[model samples]
Target chain A: MKLTIRKDQLNDAIQQVSKASSSRPAIPILGGIKFDVTHQGVTLTASDTDISIQSFIPVENGEFVIAKVERPGSVVLPAKFFVEIVKKLPSDEIEIEVKDHHQTSIRSGSTDIQMVGLDPEEFPVLPTIEESESITVPGDLIKSMIRQTVFAASTSEQTPILTGALWNLSEGQLKFVATDRHRLASRTATVQAENDYKFSNIVISGKTLNELSKLVADDNSEVEIVVTANQVLFKMGNMLFYSRILDGTYPDTSKIIPQNFKTELVLHTKKLMDAIDRAYLMSREEKTNIVRLITQEDGTIEISSSSTELGRVTEQLEVKEFKGESLRIAFNSKYMLDALKVIDSEYLFIGFTGAMSPIIIKPTDHPHSLHLILPYRTTG
Target chain B: MKLTIRKDQLNDAIQQVSKASSSRPAIPILGGIKFDVTHQGVTLTASDTDISIQSFIPVENGEFVIAKVERPGSVVLPAKFFVEIVKKLPSDEIEIEVKDHHQTSIRSGSTDIQMVGLDPEEFPVLPTIEESESITVPGDLIKSMIRQTVFAASTSEQTPILTGALWNLSEGQLKFVATDRHRLASRTATVQAENDYKFSNIVISGKTLNELSKLVADDNSEVEIVVTANQVLFKMGNMLFYSRILDGTYPDTSKIIPQNFKTELVLHTKKLMDAIDRAYLMSREEKTNIVRLITQEDGTIEISSSSTELGRVTEQLEVKEFKGESLRIAFNSKYMLDALKVIDSEYLFIGFTGAMSPIIIKPTDHPHSLHLILPYRTTG
Candidate 1:
């Protein structure tokens, strides 16, 4: 494509699609970013079989002309060099032209880089999303939900299905649930969606959602998510992200969270997080990562962790509120820290179902978010 | 030790000595930080045999009391736990008490940590510097000199002596030279020392100097370096760093640098670095990391690199001053980048004897720093 484009706009477009470009492509063309240039704008796309990202640049953005096209054409350039060189280029505008045999020349300031380009026809075309069933959510909310639930997804490939977060939509409410069997994180949000759209069993890879989170801004600006049988597409202003759904059924984690509580306590989230973090230091060194929480009759809680050879650390905290019977429990400190970190409230509610059952934690004032962790069976 | 000390002061002390504390110490005792507490203040020391660092905190700095001594004692606490827990502790003042059997209790705010302390008698004692000969230099200048030369030291253990930087002190000049055989970096500075004191064969591990670089601030404050037969000590205001000198003969590299130059070119450091950096992108992709620089018959130079399958990048630049004969030279781009990054001058002088000879680069203004790299003999 023969065009001179603003370097900043081109840099942003390159960065947006770079995440989907494979470092070691199974097919050589998969490592290249395909550019389709026209008088309307330039579309840059990259894909690696599982995910594809495309970004668009308009001819003019208000008063500033983003691109001046001499001829409309297509070519695929190596993503690594294209991405890095543009960021380091010295000038405000960069001229890219396709020469004989698809060789591309990028001229900016004093540098002239001639990169061997691939035939655009060799690049895999992104599968079109045909389904009209779509849900809209604020970019900020989706980013937050991904941050809260994605980390709990299993990192191991032993059970490939657990590596994705299950997305469910019904009655204008969108919920995300992720579990690795030991710990689970579930977050619910009221999305802008059709009332009768009841969908379930949609498991999107946590890795894909995490990348999407980085591309989307943390603003209330809207994003439309169109879902098909095996693929999902997210539309953000000038960018489009497409990801393939994992080909398995996500487990029903409905019964994992404890319902009845024997002991319930409320504590300042930051304070509790601080105390547990200190205890986590010892547990991490032990590699067991087990820390104990004990509720006392004196209206307080003690957080402690001990190593056989390294001694113990204990924090006596005067909780904000407490109720129900007293109990002692042990759970993975790292898991607890992760769950607590996502709670955005001043205080958090923690409920224990008699030490053996799963512990449920939630923001004190909200019913939309819940975190559950299985307790360690400690002989106390 | 039984003292209530300011957490910030203690934290700073912990961070300073932490580098000498090995993550996987050879002896169990070496994994602990020895606390020598007296009525005056507290002294923290950590060592992994090869290097030891000791930092002192006094009872008072001017009118502000840093620590209130309740009892005089000594104990060794596990460095891993002690360092992290103190940083996360809730209060400013931490109360430390040594109980029966050397059990240490550290109480701060609502948290209480009891660590198994090793017998202080088992800790290695820092060696006392016996030599009266020493050199003092500004901390900022020494730090700069280390940064400029240390990266050239060999990371491989095959030539153990090349892993250290040779320190040569003659008259009032202190010099550092490091080489991994392929390239060499040398930096020199006049020191604040006795004019007749001359020392040589003091080679400190590059890794040790890198750690020292992190600890010393970028200020023109004075630091005393005391040298003995096999040990070197750096005394900052409140911290003392002791390192063991590597035992081996450094190779004589005096004859390596070319004094008779056929070509001399001076160019803007930043502009040349940028152009070469772009060319490096292609070379890095090819994995050979080789970039070529050719001085043209025209009053300009060209920086370029190419991959057999990926094409080429060329940057033609205007020169401030070029008196070099037309010659083409290739070198490892990464080594050149490393050398250019440490130059504190706006312009740099590059001298070449021939296409096959060593390339010498020095700051255009002064002779405080010099870098030499062997050119790749390209069959062209």
Candidate 2:
């Protein structure tokens, strides 16, 4: 296909779709980005076997005109080389043309690059789902939800379903939950949907979940998520992000979430994060990276950790309010730090069932974000 | 031993010396930094056998007074843990105390760290060099000279001497030369030395060369270079850097640098660099990353390169001056780019002897920096 496009716009489009371009593709044609041009604009598509991305650039916005289109066709040029050449092409406008034998030529300023292209017929076609089963959610909310819960997904390859984040919808609430079986993160938000869908669930691979998050903007823009039997598509702005749904069943995490707790404490989020981070420098050498939390009689939470091979560190923090008796518990500092970072609230309330039980952390101001961590067994 | 110091000062000192400490060491005590406390000040030393760095923080500028030191002594604390703890300490001032059993305690704000330490007697001590063999030069000029020439040194361990930068002196003029036998770089400047001190030579390893460069400031600070038979010491401001000299003869590179050439061209450094960089993106897939240059009779230079597996790129560069007959040559673009970045000049003059001869690049304004690159054989 022949097209001329602005450097910045083309760069953004290329980067967005490049996430799906396979570096080591099982099929040779999957390594390239397919370019399809029509009278309206040019569409760029890239896909691995599991995920696919597509972007479109309109004709008017292009810096230079795609002149003398004797024919309209599609071809696949090397994605990486073409992108790099365009980025460093030294000029504001670029001209691209495809010949009869798929010989692609790109010219910008004083530089000219000619590359052999592959026939577009060999590229795989991405499947598109119907819009009937789709739900609309704010793009910023979707991006925040993914970032808040995706890190908890299991990276271990033993259980494939655990490597995916479970998305569930019921009534008017949408919930995102991910657990590596050690620690679980769940975020719930209200979204717009038609015809009260009943307990529909889709488990998306953690990688695709993260990549789809980047495609969403932090503005008030809305994105439509269309779910089919085995595929899901996220349409945001001018980009389309598609990923294959995980096949296995996800474990039910509802029963493990604590409903009753004897002790609860409220602490400033930044203060707790800073205390844990300071303690982290010392405890990081240990495998568990465990840090002990002690609620004092005077309403102070003391954080302490030690490694026999490295050293010991203790930090004291002030809590806003405390109930029940003084208690001490130990948990992975990294998990606590990660959970604390996504809370988005100034203050957090932590609920403890017992020293040996999982501790639940929730924002005091906003209850939408919830984080749970399993305590580590310590001699103290 | 007991003392208190400012967290920022302690952190800076530790970071400076920590560069000399490696995670793996031949001796156990070598993995730690030796802290010596006295009524005057506190000194910290770290070494990885080959190089050693020391920084002293006097009591006057320190945050806290040297508390009850019933006895003055020294002990070695694990360098990695100590540095991290100091950097993340919560308080403005950190208190450190070492027990007779070699256990050290550090307290800052509400955080306390205790670590196991080693006997300072077991650590290898750096030998003090006599002051008579020292040559003083401006720190900024020395740092620039090192940066300009050190990159040309061979990185391979097979030829140990070639991995070092050669220092030669004649009539109070100091010159640094480095080469991998393919390309050579040399920088010369005047230094303060006795008139009778005609000549001396030393070769410092590239690893140490890089560390020494960091120690020197870019400001007009004075630095002393003290040379011993086995080791060379660089005194910059309050920091002391000592490195073992490479024990071998350096190859002479003066004869290889071309004094006169049949063709000469002067071009803008930035423009030439950008063109070469663009050509690099196309030729990177090739074995040598080779780019060819053809000086046309019409006063423009044609740059081009191609990869059998990738693609081809061609660019034209307008020249300000062309003094000789038209010529064509090919060279590794990366080497030229490196030389271009280090030369502190707006305009660069390139001297070409023939199609397959070594090309010399020098600054039109500054005569101190020189870069020589060997030509690559191009197939017709």
Candidate 3:
């Protein structure tokens, strides 16, 4: 493969594909990145058995020329060293030529690097998915949804299915749910789909979804997602992101979400976040991470935590509004802080069914997203 | 202790002293910061046996009232948690009050934190150094000199003295030198000192100097350094940094630095640095980090490196001046890069003593600093 590409363009494309390349691959050949140069442009692909990513650079895009292909050929190069070399080359234009026996020479400015390349036939073929069952959603919306719910996914490998986030589509509404048994986060948004097209139990690894979110360029750009029996493909601009779906069934979390509350409070999000954060430091020393919240008769809430060796901390914040009953509850401050950060609202609405029941929280401006945390039992 | 202090002033002082506090200390009280409040202001001190740092915030500094001392008292608070709590307090002014049995209450805005404190008598007292054997130098110049030479110090604990930089004073000149057997760096500067006060064989840990460098506020500000039999104290602004000296005899490195060379080259520092940096990446894979430089008859130098598994890279750069004889030599590229990065000149003068002798590097504009790297013997 012979091609002269712009340094910046090639660097960006290499970085995008390198994300899928694993440092330790079960198959040694899987650690390489496949480079294909054709009359149209150059395409780079990398995979690690679970996820595959491919980025393409056209010969000409608008008034700029990203690359020029003199001969159509293909080769696979070690992804780690190849990317680093390309990034540090000291020239605007780089010329790559693959000679006989897969000997590749890269020249830029006064520097020239010759690297050994593997045969492209050794690489695994990219999976093909039908475009018939596809849904279009804004890139920004999907990224936001993934960030809001992905952190709640279980990181342990004991329950493989819990390591992924479930994607459900029904009645033009798309929802994502992730849970680690202790806490759960759910976010819903509207997407453009066919009336009869609906997908359920499509679980993608939270780690893979987070990588895909970073590839999204802008909020207004549309991302097309196609689902098949075993794999899911996300197409954005000139890049394709593909991942394998988990095999197990996701548990029904809707029943656990409380519908009504015996106590409710609304307060500014930043004010409450700051108060709990301070209390968390003290509780962290005790290894419980438990912070207590008590509603005062004067319409204010007191947050406090104590450690046997570090003493205690108490802070009071005036709530915007309170209803139902004044109660005292203890919960993990880290879980509440994580939920509060992604609410995307000035004021947060917190609902409590009882001292032992799950507490539900949502943004006051929008009710599409919700977070649930289980309160800890304390013998006050 | 009862005091109302500005949040920012207290936070800065805590951070400065916290550096001296160790996470794991031989004595438990060494992990805490001693707070001494008087009618003048509050003095914060922390020590970890090897090093001690103290910061004083006066009652009034210029137009800003840093602290208001209502009563005089003393206490010791855990450095780790204390720094974090003060940084996150949500008020411009923080009030710290010590109740009975050293129970301290820290109040800021509506937040209140009660922390358990240790008795001030348990903390070690700060050492006193005589100002008779002191030298004053610009803080910025000393910091630069430390940066230029400290990286060459040996990090291994095998030779404790090598981990420290040798500080020598003679005829109003201060010199610093560090080496790890393979490479050496030396920097010299003129300081204001008593003509009769001359000391040699004084070595301080590179790690301690690096921490002290960060505390230097301004380049033009004077730093008063007092040297004692076992400790050295540096007073910069209102902060005092004290570190124990390494007790050992430093090897003489002057005998190894060659005065004459068979080949000489003067080139742009940045250009040569970039070329060697690229070659170093290839050599790094071979585990030698060795790059070869060959001077051509046309007054240009070729930099190249090859790996058995990864092929090779070669780059040519034009030299501004070439004299003596054409020669080829090999050396560790990392050492060359480090020396090149610290040189404060546009053109670097590189002197090669032969094929196997040490190479000397210095900036063309200054003769006070020098770097030496030993050559690797290649069979070819």
Each candidate's lDDT (Cα)?
0.91, 0.85, 0.92
* Window of ten residues with lowest summed lDDT in model 3 chain B: B125-134
Candidate 1 off by > 4 Å: none
Q: Which lDDT tens digits does candidate 1 get at residues A1-380? A: 69999999999999999899999988789999999999999999999988999999998999989999999999999897789889999899999999999999999998998889999999998997786978898888999999999999999999989999999888988999999999999999988787598788899999999999999976778899998889989999999999999998898888676688888888999999999999999888789899999887788899999998889999999888888898889999999999999998999999888878999999987888899999999888
What candidate 2 gets wrong by more than 4 Å, as runs, is A61-71, A195-199, A218-220, A294-302, A325-328, A378-380, B62-71, B192-199, B218-220
Question: Residue B366 deviation, candidate 1, in Å?
Answer: 1.2
Kindly list the per-residue Cα lDDT of model 2 for residues B1-380, writing each as its tens digit: 88777788788888889889988877768788999988777788999978999988777645555333444678899998888767777778888888868888888887777888899988888887887766788988888888999999999998999999999888888999999988999999989977655445589998798887887776879988888888888887778999998988887788898899989999999889889998998889786889999998789999998887567889899897889879999999989988999989999999999988999999999788899999998775
Task: Encode model 3's per-residue lDDT on A91-197: one tens digit a residue.
Answer: 99999999999999999999999998889999999998876878999988999999999999999999999999999999889999999999999999999998778
Question: Would you list the rank order by lDDT, best first?
Answer: 3, 1, 2
Candidate 3 residue-wise lDDT at B9: 89
- Per lDDT, the best of the predicted structures is 3
Docking quality tier of candidate 2?
medium
- Residue-level lDDT of model 1, residues B1-380, one tens digit each, is 58899999999999889789989888889989999999988999999988899999999999999999988999999898899889899999999999988899999999999889899999998998886877888889889999999999999999999999999999799999999999999999999788689889899999999998888866768889998889999988889999999999999988999987888889899998998898898899789888998888787999999997788999998888877477789999989999999999999999989988999999988999999999888877
- Model 1 steric clash pairs: none
DockQ of each: 0.84, 0.67, 0.81
Candidates 2 and 3, the one with greater DockQ: 3
Instruction: Please report the interface RMSD of model 2 to 1 decimal.
Output: 1.7
